[model samples]
Target: MHVDVKELKGHPGAQRTLSRTVEAPSGLGTVLVGIAEHSDLDLDLRVESVHEGVLLTGTASAEVTGQCGRCLDPIGYPLTVDVMQLYTWTPEANQTDGDDEETREVTAELTLELEPVLRDLLVSALPFQPVCRADCPGLCSQCGFRMEDDPGHAHEQLDPRWAALASLADTLNHDDEDDDASS
Candidate 1:
C-alpha cells in the first residue's frame, strides 16, 4: 500500500492510519514448495508515522495455507508481525547553496514494499519440520509404508549388511548383561 507522507512531513507530530488487503507473491525462495500451496496471500497492515523520518511503526496480520512437511497434508496457520522502519528521502542533486533555502523539504509520499518483507516474515515463522497431527505415524523407512494407515504392516529387514551389525549389537548387549550378572 502506498502512503502519502507529505502532510506528515510538514507537521512534525502528525500521524496517519491505514488499512488494506494485499495479495503477496509465491515462489521458490518466497514460499517453500511443500509448505506453501498457494501464491495468493491476504494481509492486514496498520501503519502510523511518528517524529517525521525518525520512525514508522505498524502491525500486520495474515493467514496462510500450506502442506505439512511430514504427511503432505494441508495445514493453515495465522500470522501476525510487528513492523518498524525508518524512511529517508533523497535530496535534490542540482540545488546550490546560493538559492538560500533554509529548511530541506521532506515528503512522506512513499510506497512501502510489503511483498518481500511479508514473505520473509511468513517463511521465518514456519517450522522446519511440520507434522499433520500430533501423533502422526510417519512413513516407514523399511518398505515405504504409511505407518499411520497400516499399523499392522511388518517391517522386513532385507539388508544383510545391517543384519551383521544388528547381530554384533545383540552380542555386545549380551556381554554387558553377563558382566552385570557377574558383578
Candidate 2:
C-alpha cells in the first residue's frame, strides 16, 4: 500500500480514490471485541500541498464481522475512519532559509506508506467491548451455564469444602448483624 510521491506531485490538489479488501491482522491491539474477521475498505484519499508539506485527507469505511465477547455470538459492525496526514520531503531543520546557510537538499524519490496507517485507523474505530445484545444476561458463575437462555436453572454446589466455607461466612455475618441490632 505504498504510493509514490512523484505521482502525487504531478497532480497537486488532485484527488485519488482507492478500494481494497484487506485481512485483519492478528494481535492484541488489532483484535476488535466483535470484529476481527476480514474487512472490505472503501478509501477516498486527496493529495494536496499545504505549507510546504503534502497533506492527505480522506474517509475510510468498512464492514467487520466477528464473535461477541460475552456470549460468543456472531456480530457485524460498520467501521468508519476520517484521517488527515502530512508528509514533508524537505528535512525539518532545512525548511528555514536563514537557518540553513548551506544549499537545500531535495531527494529525487519519496514514498508514502499506507499499510500501517490503514491498520491503525480500522483498529481504533472498533468498540472496546462489544456484546451480542444490550441486555445480555451473560453466564452463571457457579455452573458455567448461560443465564440468558435458562431462567429457571438452579446451580447446585456439590463440593463440601466450598459449601462449608459459604455456610460459615453466612453464619458469621448473621451473628454480626444480630449483635448490631441488639446494641
Candidate 3:
C-alpha cells in the first residue's frame, strides 16, 4: 500500500487519481470487530502536490466482520472511511506552527506508506462495542439466558432481611392446614 509521489513532489497543484483494490493487512480492527484478513480494500484516492508535501484525499471501503460485543452474535457490515492526509516534505514543514499533531513524511525515495494511514483511519472508525443491532436485548445477567427469546423472563427475588420471615410464614401456614384437617 505504498504510493509513489515522486512526480507530485515539489510540483504544486499537480494531482493524480489513485484507484485500486488491495488485500487488507492483518490486525485492521479491534477485539470486537475489524476487516477480515486478506479481504478486499478498495482505495479511491486523489493525490495532489502541495507546498508542504503531498496531500491525499478520498475514500477507502472494506467489509467489516466480527461478533457483537453485547449478545455475542455474529455481525457483518461494510465500512467506508474518508481519507485525508498530508505527507510533509520535511519534518520542519509542520513545526512552524508548533502543532503537536503527528505528521506523515514522504520518504527520501518519494514514497508514502499508505497502510499505516489506512489502518489508523479504518481501525479508529470501528465501534468499541459492536452490536448485531441497535436494540439487541442481549443475554440475561442472572442466568445467562438469551433475553431475546423471552423479554419478560425473570426470577422471584426476595429481600434477604425478610427471607427468614417468609420461610417461617410458610411453615405456619402448613401447620394451620394440618390442624384444620385433623379437626
Candidate 4:
C-alpha cells in the first residue's frame, strides 16, 4: 500500500483522508507468535502534510488465524491497531532530530510505501504467547493431551533430590523385615 505524496508535496499542511482494503503480503505474520498472515486489511487513514513531510494516522483491522501457543489448538481472531507515522521529506533541511532508526526518510519521488509499517503494527498487536482461552488448561505434560478435556490428568513425579532418600528407606525396611523373620 503505497501512497503518493503529490497532494501534500508542494503545499504544507495539506491533508487527505483514505479508506481502502489492501491485501497484506504473504507470510507477513511470520514475525509474531500465533499470528498467521492475513489476506486483507482495511485501512482508514488520514494523510496530512506537515513541515517535515507527511503524517499518516489511522486504524487498520484484519483477521488472523493460527494455533494457540499453549495447547496448540486451532485459533483465529480479529486484530485492530492504530497507526501514527511520519515520513519526513529528505535532504539536509528537514532532518529529524530523533534516533536515525526512529525516523522515516521519504523517497526522492515522494511516495510512502506502507507495507512494512502495516506489517509491524499488526504483528506488534498480536500476543507473544497466545492461548485458546483466558484460563486455558494447556496440554498435560505427561500425555501431551488437552488438559481441559481430561480433567483427571496427572503423573506420578519423584524429584531427583529425593530418589536417594527413598532408596535408603526401602533398604532399611528390608533389613528390619529380615531380622524379624530370623527371630
Cα displacement (Å) at residue 52, model 3: 0.7
Candidate 3: TM-score?
0.90
Please, what is the whole-model Cα lDDT of each candidate in the order they appear?
0.55, 0.63, 0.92, 0.80
TM-score per model over all chains:
0.61, 0.63, 0.90, 0.82
Instruction: Tell me the number of clashing residue pairs for each predicted model.
Output: 2, 0, 0, 0
Worst 10 residues of 2 by lDDT: 99-108
Order of models, best lDDT first: 3, 4, 2, 1
In candidate 1, what are the lDDT values of residues 76-163, reduced to their tens digit? 7666666555553444421433544232223434545455555555667666676666887767677667777988778665588688
lDDT tens string, model 4, 10-68? Answer: 78878989999877676556432433444778899999988877889999988877777
Candidate 2 lDDT over residue span 78-118, tens digit each: 77789666665577635654532332222446666665676
In candidate 3 the C-alpha lDDT for residue 131 amounts to: 96
Across residues 97-165, which tens digit of lDDT does each residue of candidate 3 receive?
466766799988899999999999999999988999999999888898988999999988899999999
What's the alpha carbon RMSD for model 3? 1.9
Stronger candidate by TM-score (2 vs 3): 3
Worst 10 residues of 4 by lDDT: 29-38
Which pairs clash in model 1?
A: 5-108, 5-109
Instruction: State in Å the error of residue 50, model 3.
Output: 0.4
Candidate 1: count the clashes: 2
